[model samples]
Target chain A: MADASYPDGLLYHPEHDWAQIDGETATFGITWFAQDALGEVVFFDPPQVGVQVTQGESYAEVESVKAVSDVIAPLSGEIVEVNADLADAPERINDDPYGEGWMVKVKLADAGEQQGLMDAAAYQAQLG
Target chain B: MVAAPSDTLRRTALFDRHVAAGARLVPFAGWEMPVQYAGVRAEHLAVRARAGVFDVSHMGEVETRGPGALAFLQRMLSNDVSQIAVGGAQYSVLCREDGGVLDDLFTYRLADDRFLTVTNAANHAKDLAWLRAHADGFDVQLADRLDDYAMLAVQGPAARELLAPLADGPLPARFHTAELTVAGVPALVCGTGYTGEDGVELLCAPAGAPAIWDAVLAAGVVPAGLAARDTLRLEACFHLYGNDLMESRGPIEAGLGWCCKEATGFVGAEAVAAARAAGPAERLVPFAFTGPGIPRQGNAVVGGGEVTSGTLSPCLGVGVGMAYVPAERAVVATEIEIDVRGKVRPAVVADKPLYRKAA
Candidate 1:
């Protein structure tokens, strides 16, 4: 079956990550497609909750059974709430990468940074 | 079917056939090989429950024939090749005299004087050159026939049931081979595989691979790729060459002590014998997590002041892994911790072959 996608109100990154902005808070997670290609997420290496991230820079890593891949920052921000749920249940990334699998919530360093990332159609083309 | 990239790593003879069958092509060992047609977990379950087909033609096939073939192999390999009866196969390693592994391979005893060696794709040339350089006075003809032969592995419990109908004769009783016609194509069906499952590896002419692939696919056999193969093998606790075992590792250290038969005076005899006599300093142990975290390869496995390879097992629902445990922590069921993120999670020394069918 085809996988589900992140719901509306989320900004997507070409690298298959999502940034959902709520006021100054931005919750982020990988897209459904990224988790599928990664097989199973065995381990995660996210920056500390208060760590700062720059758009386009790799601020975290995810290791699957077959290979290890990086989780790039979607927008410049400071981590406000890193998903504590994922530290114990990385499968959340595999089962629901966009929801409970939310990787990190950020206080957007610059709201304008959203323009650099992809929208739904653009990210879908990246899959092609 | 997906359009395969022209610049994709070179394909085996069955490349086009795999693409046509909707097999997912991925780069493996520098070659374009199908990872799966349906899906990795699906194909893996099929191979476990029913049957699945795998295109392993990318693996190198080396032929050593003539009078001194047996002696030559006996000297180059760590296992006693001379012990294998005709039509039998022995899993052995090509080793340097220093006891380091070059490549772990299967040696097929085609005849009393003829042998076929299958090495991993990445180590083909090195294995061949090592054997050739050491063959100074041996009377043998070595040929690299990998390009000429295509190997198909139909594996699982129902492997024989599915293949019996396609073959002209009854399936070869386990580990034996038969000269047969599969889907009207001339083929040699040998019972062997890497998944630790019951199966046959069909070695046939390059021209016949396509036909054979179609015949198997048409029979409802799931098409599996390296992804499934890796997980399946991991479930069986089989070591991957580059990961679990390598040039820096020895058979004794890798839990392959059985293959280091002392009877054969192979190249690494002295070192292996010494290591065996002295006892190994570290041991490879299978472990699993019940709490939280899936261990990936290269993750640090901490126990008794030692760190080793920790990886998630695709077969076992839990995080299973292999690691070099110090002598103290090598005991079965010893507790250990795997560093997942900054948290050192609890893990247990689990049983080997964490996923195995009833005997």
Candidate 2:
């Protein structure tokens, strides 16, 4: 988690979130940069599965021992599923931010929004 | 990562060491300080279980000497200054004439006529000015020793054992101090710590701090940061100056009446005595969440109070915090509710030191 990394085929938001687009459905989670900056995630308060999320807005919260940070939504969507495993083991957000740490599965409101997000290369460049 | 402007912020003598250790530095009390190194929970547990060393050089120091030193301190500090023997340490609060707290300090009596008081970094300049303004007729000489020394606190159950090998002589006992050579440098070793653990605080010259810090770390003491320090102290129910004890509040209301001796007639003694006689309406007490939510500073209490300090206690594995609630509701086992952000969380007022060491 010390080194910064961004995987290919994933879209990145300036707020340090990643979206894996799959047809009308997408998975969202915070990036390694976000988790590393948050220091160990001790608690993850997820939003309800039916909740609506708007781009560039906070939909959930993650708390460390010393601070609490809002988990920003990268795209507008209606959450179809929430990661229930994070309730007991939130450190997975730091251990595997992309795969096991996926926060919510959403049905995209507008698939066109994906064109606005940056690719892995562009996101890594912005981090510099 | 978002970065603060570092040009205006001060750096301690161990700034380079913190950077080398990959600490996540943040702005604290106008200084670029490490909030965490490995992690807050890990560092906090390290101190509670084994040993952890902290770079507390951001804390300031003041030296008071001369014939009227004791008398001057008696008027300024809440405790009975005359009672502190040489080579002893005492904790007291500095108060305004109106009884509002100014700062909490720990004074070490280095000699019959000389004493050194450690000040909170945020209130150091204000404390120095207040002391100097009140020194009109006293024969005391006050010197700001902020830049002269760097402080390191080695804390935990094994703190003494880990530090003893590096000391030229025996370590100081609780509430005591000794002049010893540590890591080949002359240092003032004091048996005092903010964490609820047996530990010693070392004060060494700024130039010699790195050597001593490296030596202590090499001895297997985990390097902790300010974030861990706060969690540990809060779990121990120690009052933080800005959060728990503010200038708008008196020491009595903060549950620090035990340290304020009215017979000493220190500044604000009359108001403190009056408050004691009448009893403060609200008293600060430690509380822990009975459920899931973590309370935060400025969180509203359900009825009529506010949480001043809050954190997820690593040792207790639950949310613990201190709040100023009505005196009638401050008893242990009293059920309370904390408005964490929006949702209300059930809590119970507990005794001091929310976390206790296992026997």
Give the best candidate by TM-score: 2
Off by over 4 Å in 1: A1-10, A32-63, A75-128, B1-8, B303-311
Best by DockQ: 2
Per-candidate interface DockQ score: 0.35, 0.62
* Candidate 2 regions with alpha-carbon error over 4 angstroms: none
TM-score, chain B, each candidate: 0.93, 0.99
Candidate 1, chain A: TM-score against the reference:
0.91
* TM-score of each candidate structure, all chains considered together: 0.87, 0.98
Tens digits of per-residue lDDT for model 1, B1-359: 13456685878888887788777687777799887776666777889998888889888889999999988888888887877889787888777887888999988888889888888999998888888898889999899877878889999988888777888887666767677899888887787787878889898888998888888878878788877887787777787788778888788887888898766788888888888888887877777787756666666666443334445555666777777777567677888887765568788876777687776
User: How do the residues B1-359 of candidate 2 rate in per-residue lDDT, one tens digit apiece?
Assistant: 45755799998889999999989889999889988998898899999999999999999999999999999999999999888999999999999988899999999999999999999999999999999999999999999999998999999999999999999999999999999999999999999999999999999998999999999999999999999999999999999999999999999999999889989889899999999999999999999999886889999999999999998888887889999999999899999999988889999999978999877
What is the model-wide C-alpha lDDT for candidate 1?
0.79
How far out, in Å, is residue B33 in model 2?
Answer: 1.5
